[model samples]
Target: MSYFFQIVVSGMVVGSIYALAALGLVLVYKSSRVANFAHGQIIAAGAFITFYLTTTVGIPIFFSFLASMVITFFLAMSVERIFLRRLIGEPIISVIMVTIGLASIIDGLIYLTPFGTENFSFPPFLPQDPLSLGGVSISWTQLVGMIITFIMIGGFSWFFKKSTVGISMRAVSDDQFGSMSVGISVPRVFGLAWATAGLSAAAAGCIIGNITGLNFDTLHAFGIVVFPVVILGGLDSILGAVVAGIIMGLIQQFASGYLDGNWGLNGTGDVMPYVILLIILLFKPHGLFGIHEIERV
Candidate 1:
């Protein structure tokens, strides 16, 4: 029972991070209808920037995090303005391919840096000991990461529900033509969505960096994993992303906890999501929270 509770706790921590990461993808998809392949690169770049700020420039970790978020915000906006803006209203396939190309370009750029290949962890700023409840244990980093994830999630939810800009973004997502007719700048909303996505990605990246160390590959992989999260949650639903993220995280934890060692099923957690994603696509293609738009043959 204690072990089960421990897995549940850790799974929630991981799932919240996934939720935050997927939120960025959801934001972009909701407003622009273009899936960003460059998102992983953006996440990796954000983490690398923090590493540079902390280790090379000697700033404190906290300030470096904020600084990285600001930088990525502009970077993502520039990406939209310069690259995606021109391609707007073009074929969706072309837009997705452009993002894929941009991802490759960013990947090449990161390969030039030393941080790309090395392993780095944050300086020990939290307690070394784990907090225990009964037989279950939790670490300070996981606790902090989960709290920040929830706060960010709540803040974004409130922003979407109440703020003027948020309302405008929703309007744009609902119908670009309708939004434009009503005096909303659809393009500007798209830019804002990307900026907010970048902000959230940076936060997710920083938390991941703190918890798992500054590994470029690991942090960037979240971009790929986010697809399943969004698919399960619903492509355009923020609430869906959160719920699906937690579910996926639990599945992963359970698979790793139970399926490993008993059989030759090593690393089942890593591959199971994609398999489940395939199954979901076959039957419930729209996913749980996704707006169903299936056309039957």
Candidate 2:
């Protein structure tokens, strides 16, 4: 029973991070209707930047974390402005290909840096002890990371629902032409969406780096992993992302705990998400929270 609860705790921690990371994909799709293949690179870059700032620049981890998010925010905006901006009116497939190309370009660029192949871990600032509750133990790093993740989630939820810029973003997402008619800059909203996604990606990166030592490949894989999460949660629904993230996390954790231990199922945790994704695609193609558009042809 204790072990079960422990797995639940672990699942929630991982799920919260997934929710935050998935938000990046959601935001980009909501605004520009383009998927960001370069998102993983951005996540890795943010972790590396934070690591560099903390270890080399002698800044505190907390401050470095903020600095990385801010830096990535503008960097993402610049990417949108310089590359994606030109391809705005292009076909969706073309834009997606550009993103894949951008991902490769960023991959090559990161390979040039020391962080590309090397592994790094953030310096420990939190206490070494784990918090134990009813025989379930969670480390300080995990707890703090989980708290930070939820706080950002809550803040973004508020921003998305109540803020003027957020409202404008939603308006643009729904109808770019209609938003333009009302004085909203569609391009600008697209830039803002990317920037905000970058911000969340950075935060996710820092938390992940703190919890799991940073390796370029391991960190970047998060981009691929969150795809199932966002897909399961409906690409356009923020609430769906959160709920789906938690669900996926729990499923993975439970599979690892029960299936692997009892049935000799190996790698079930990693594979379960894709299985669920296939199921969702077959049965709930729009995802649990995705809006179904009925076109009148």
Candidate 3:
């Protein structure tokens, strides 16, 4: 029972990270309907930038974290402006391919840096001991990361529900033509969507880097992992993203804890999400919160 509870605690921590990372992907898809293949690259860039600022430039970690978010916010906006802006109104395939190309370009650029080949961990500012309760223990880093992740999630929820810019973005998502008729700049909204996604991605990357250390491959893999999360949550639903992320996290942790060594399975945790993804697609393709759209010719 204690082991089960331990897995639960661990799952919550990991789920929070998944929620944070998947939030950005959902944001992009919700507003612009663009599946950002370069999102993981952006996440990696944010993590690497934060690391550089903290380690090389000697900035404090918290400050570097904020700095990285701001930088990526603009960086993503520029990406939209320069590369994706002209591709607007083009075929969806063209946009997706462009993002894929952007990912490769970012990968090449990172490979030129030490981060691409080396591993690094954040400087520990928290107490180097795990907090324990009834045989369940969590590290300070994980606890702090969880707290911050929830705060960011709450903030985003409020922004979407209450803020003017957020409302405009949502309006565009609901109906771009109608939003434009009401005087909203659809293209600007698209840019804002990407910018906000980048900001969230930066936050996710920093949290992940702190929790798991810095490895280019590992950090970027969050991009691929996010697909399962968002797909499970619903491609365009923020609430669904949060719920599905936690569900996926719990499933992964429990699989690792109970199923990994029980049979021939060795890495069930790593593979379970995709297995679930396939099952979900075959059955509930619209996902838990996704609205089924009907089109007639």
Candidate 4:
């Protein structure tokens, strides 16, 4: 029972990170309808920047985290301007392929940096001691990560619900032509969406780095995994993203905790989500929270 509780605690920690990561993907998809394959690279860049600032440049970790968020904001915006802006109104397949290409390009660029290959940890600022409750232990790093994630998620929820810019984004998502007729600059909204997504990606990266240590490979892989999260939650719903992310995280933890080494399953955690995703796609194509459009057959 204690062991089961331990897995649940860890699952929440990991699920929170997934929720943060999926938030960015949902932000971009909500406004632009563009699935960003380059998201992982942006995440990797954010993690590396934080690592560089804290370790090499001698800045504090907190400041480095904010700086990385700012940097990726512009980095993602410029990427939008250069690569995606021209491809506006292009076929969806073309746009997706372009983002995939951009992801590859960023991966190649990161590979040139020493940080890409090396493993680095944040400076020891948190207590090494673990907090315990009835035989379940949680570390400070994970606790902090979860706190930051919830704060950010709450902030984003408020943004989408109350902010002017966020409402404008929702308008565009609902009907681009209708929004444009009302004088909303659709392109600008798209850019802003990408920018916000980038910012969230950076925050997620920093938190993950602090908890798991800085590793380019590990940080970027979240990009791919976020697809299942977004799909399960409904691609355009922020609430869906959060709920789905937690669900996926818990599912992953439970699988790895109980299913591994039973009947020769090596890595159930890594593969099960994708399998579930495919099953979801086949049946619940609109996802749990996705808006349903009825087409008369």
lDDT tens readout by residue for model 4, 43-148: 8888888888888999988998999999999988888888998988899999999999999999999989887798888888889999988999999989999999
Off by over 4 Å in 4: 294-297
lDDT score, candidate 1, position 77: 92
Write down the lDDT of every candidate, Cα atoms only: 0.89, 0.92, 0.94, 0.91
Q: Rank the candidates by lDDT, best first.
A: 3, 2, 4, 1
The CA lDDT at 137 in model 2 is 96
- Candidate 3, residue 79: the lDDT equals 96
Model 3 whole-model lDDT (C-alpha atoms): 0.94
Misplaced by over 4 Å in model 3 are none
How well does each candidate superpose onto the true structure, as a TM-score?
0.97, 0.98, 0.98, 0.97
In model 1, which regions exceed 4 Å deviation? 294-297
> Which residue pairs overlap in candidate 4's backbone?
none
lDDT of 4 at 193: 90
Full ranking by TM-score: 3, 2, 4, 1
lDDT winner, 1 or 4:
4
Q: Which ten residues in a row have the lowest lDDT in candidate 4?
A: 115-124
What are the RMSDs of all candidates, in order?
1.5, 1.0, 0.8, 1.3
Angstrom error at residue 68, model 3: 0.4
